[model samples]
Target: MRAMDEATVRHVARLARLELTEADVRRFAADMSKITDFVSALREVDVQGAEMTLHPIANRNQWREDEAQPGFKREDAVSNAADSEQNFFKVPPVIE
Candidate 1:
């Protein structure tokens, strides 16, 4: 893969609303180039017939027997709230 260029870095910075200096663009381009090289090197690996392994741990769906359990009281659940009204926790308004 070709190394990422200054133009591409500058374009990306603009899209992200970043104010990158020339030095910042050059540094980011160098880092991106190294990442591209690593990915390109990975593409050359032989994985034919290799099963796709999702997780490193081989254990699959080891679950305990489901049973009814005691649940927490409503008051206990909201006991630590800074503000509570009508049996529910009240939080600061987030949206206008």
Candidate 2:
């Protein structure tokens, strides 16, 4: 793998809106190089005829009895809010 250059680092810093110092840029270059090397090594792994696995443990959707359950009161739900009216919590207007 090719070594990470200063131009590439500067370009990335600009895109990420990062204000990196000269020392930070040098350190980041080294770290990014190591990460690239690790990814390159991963590319060498053979996974021919391998089935994709989402989780290691066997899992199934557990069903429960659908019954009416008592829940928290409306007053309790808005108790912690800064502003509330008519049993509803008030929030800042999202649209002008």
Candidate 3:
């Protein structure tokens, strides 16, 4: 596998909105290069008869019954709102 270059690392950082120093770019370039090299090595492993599994360990979801519950009053819920009307929190218009 080709080594990860500084240019690629910088481009990825830009896409992620990261502010990286020159040292960070160089470090990430080396780190990503190692990762790709390891993955390349893994590609050579024999798995012709290996069974695909979603997870290493077995897991199951616990089911629960749905139940109705009482909640806070409307007045109390909106008590901290800067502006409210008709039991609803009001905010500035987002459009226009």
Candidate 4:
């Protein structure tokens, strides 16, 4: 990979729908170049036997068994609604 340049930075900004000034573009190019260099350095590391983990530390998930439960009655559920029809809440139209 090559270091990020002014043209590449401008292209990326255009693709992202950003409007950047010349000074901003120059600053971003330098920042992006540093990031690219860091990533290139990381590619040189040897990790053939390293285990992939989602997090830095090991954690156990707390799980619970699925169980059926009773639900509220239609009347009770719609009791607080300002308007309800056929056990469903009624709201003002959002679209024409």
* lDDT at residue 72 of model 4 (Cα atoms): 94
Task: Assess candidate 1 and give its lDDT.
Answer: 0.91
What would the per-residue lDDT of candidate 3 be over residues 32-77, giving only the tens digit for each residue?
A: 9999898898688898999889898888997777876788999999
lDDT (Cα atoms) of all candidates against the true structure: 0.91, 0.91, 0.92, 0.92
Candidate 2 Cα lDDT to native: 0.91
The TM-score, computed over Cα atoms with residue i paired to residue i, of candidate 1 is 0.44
Instruction: Please give me the total number of clashing residue pairs in predicted model 4.
Output: 0
Error of 1 at 16 (Å): 2.1
lDDT per residue, candidate 2, 1-96, as tens digits?
Answer: 988888899999999999999999999899999899778986788989988789998899998899978998999998898999998988899899
Per-residue alpha-carbon lDDT of candidate 1 for residues 10-45, written as tens digits (9 for 90 to 100): 999999999999899999999999998888987888
Ranking by TM-score: 3, 2, 4, 1
Score residue 77 of candidate 1 by CA lDDT.
90
* TM-score for each predicted model, relative to the true structure: 0.44, 0.47, 0.53, 0.45
lDDT tens string, model 4, 14-96?
A: 99999999999999999999988888987888989988878988888987778867899998999999999999999999899
Show model 4 residue runs off by greater than 4 Å. Answer: 47-96
Q: Would you list the clashing residue pairs of candidate 2?
A: none
